[model samples]
Target: MSAPLRLILFDVDGTLVDSQATIFAAMRAAFSAAGLETPTRPALLSGVGLSLPVLMKMLVPEADERTQDQLVTGYKEAYHDLRLTQGAAHSPLYPGARGLLEQLSETPDVLLGVATGKSKRGLDQLIEAHGLERMFVTRQVADHHPSKPHPSMIDTARSEIGASQGDTVMIGDTSFDMQMAEAAGVAGIGVTWGYHPRDALGSAQHMVEDFAQLAGVLNKFWTVDHE
Candidate 1:
């Protein structure tokens, strides 16, 4: 009999790609264009998994909806300019990320998906630039779903990929990801080499310090021990 299919969903920023520098630069440009103060790195990183408007609101709670809208527009413009100028350097994959994805793709029963706060355009750009258009089976973006911790993205990805909650795993680097996984009744695996601190991922079913550990954890998850 064929092995059951399993779904592995990944977050883009702060999880697969180290886009903090670009994200910070874009935020700074956005705030500056809106004549607002730029938030600190830690403050901004804390909201990495949220949608742009939600992130702007959290970062500048005092700002009105109009200001938040302006900031969002400015951020999109600035990030687009940066991507055009820097190309793939705007968002490089984390160390060992590609290798592990390739390994995972080779597994016949494991299907890969993306559940990220990035817009569909942004996600497509990243995937195309990095030659990852063929990597993911289901691409869930902020364009069609609510923000992180809502479980909407995961629920959709699982449904589209035909995977049960018990056979799905969400891998990310933030509490939002873990919370989303819990909300969706899927396993959450936290990676330490990202923006969020390790302690913030308490809800994760497993934690890995690096992609090497991630591979091992994934193996253990799918491998049933027959004692």
Candidate 2:
């Protein structure tokens, strides 16, 4: 008989790739182009798992809808321009991310997916740049679903992969990811080497200090049957 199918969904920004520099730069550029003051680094990083529009609004709630829209467009353009000029080399994956992903991908019962706030275009670019095109079976992005903490992305990924909630896990570095996993009725594993602090990931079912720990944790998570 075939092994039980397991779905592992990942969050892009703070989870897999450390894109803080690029994200902050784009946020600064967007705020500048909109003639608004830039938020501090911590403030910017705090919204890492949220969609661009939602993040912009959170950063500048006093701004009107038109201004929010302008900020969104500006952020996208700035981010795209940065990607073109600097390439994906600027957004490096955390230590052991590639190796762990490769190991998981080779596991017959494991199916990897991405549930991220990144747009499909951005996700595609990053995946291609990192030669990770074959890593994920399903790619859920902000353009197609509600932002993190809503469970829509995880829900969609599970559906596409035909994995039950108990057989699925969401790995990320933010409370948004943990909340989304809970909302989807799946397990959440939080990584501490990302943008959010360990305390922020209280909603996570398990927390790992680094990718090495994450790998071991995932091994157990997959091997053990979960209710």
Candidate 3:
């Protein structure tokens, strides 16, 4: 019989790429354009895994839906312009990201995927820039799904890839990701190098400090049935 498939889904912004600076810049510009007080760095980072419209609402709770929509548009415009001018390399992969991906890609029975709050265009640009277009078999973007803490992305990815919940894992930096994984009945792994604090990822089944430690954590899951 064929081995059970393992689907590893990753969050983009905080988990893989360190795009805080770029994101902060765009968010600041967007808020300014919308005539609102710019959110603090911590506030912006805290909202990393949420969709733009949801984030805008959280950042500016008093704003109406139309105003929130305008903020989302402004944020997208500013972010796109920043990428165009600074190039996609502005958001560099975290240390050991490529090595971890390379190792996972070479492992049999492993299939990679992404479930991120980034728009499809944004995710595509990041993937293409880092030559990771071939790494992820499934891509779930904010454009197509509700924000994190919702299981739609994970459910869809699992269904599309024909992977069982027991064999799927969601790796991300936020509580939202962990919550989503829990809601989807999959395992959730947290990385400490991302935006959210370690305490915030309490829902994760495992937490790793760096890429060197990630493989071992994942191996625990991979070898579970065999043991």
State every prediction's TM-score relative to the real structure: 0.98, 0.97, 0.97
lDDT of 3 by residue, 1-227 (tens): 98988899999998999999999999889989888989899999999999998899898899999989999999999999888887867699999999999899889999999999999999998898888988999999999998889999999999999999988999999999999999999999999999999999999989999988988888877777436
Model 2: per-residue lDDT, tens digit, 22-119?
99899889999989999999999999999988998898999999999999999999999988888877588888899999999998889999999999
How much lDDT does each candidate structure score? 0.93, 0.90, 0.92
Per-residue lDDT of model 1, residues 194-225, tens digit only: 98999999999899998999999998887852
Show model 2 residue runs off by greater than 4 Å. Answer: 225-227
Residue clash pairs of candidate 2: none
lDDT of 2: 0.90
- How many clashes would you count in candidate 3? 0
Q: Look at candidate 3 and give me any clashing residue pairs.
A: none
Output the worst ten-in-a-row residue range by lDDT, candidate 1.
218-227
Best by lDDT: 1
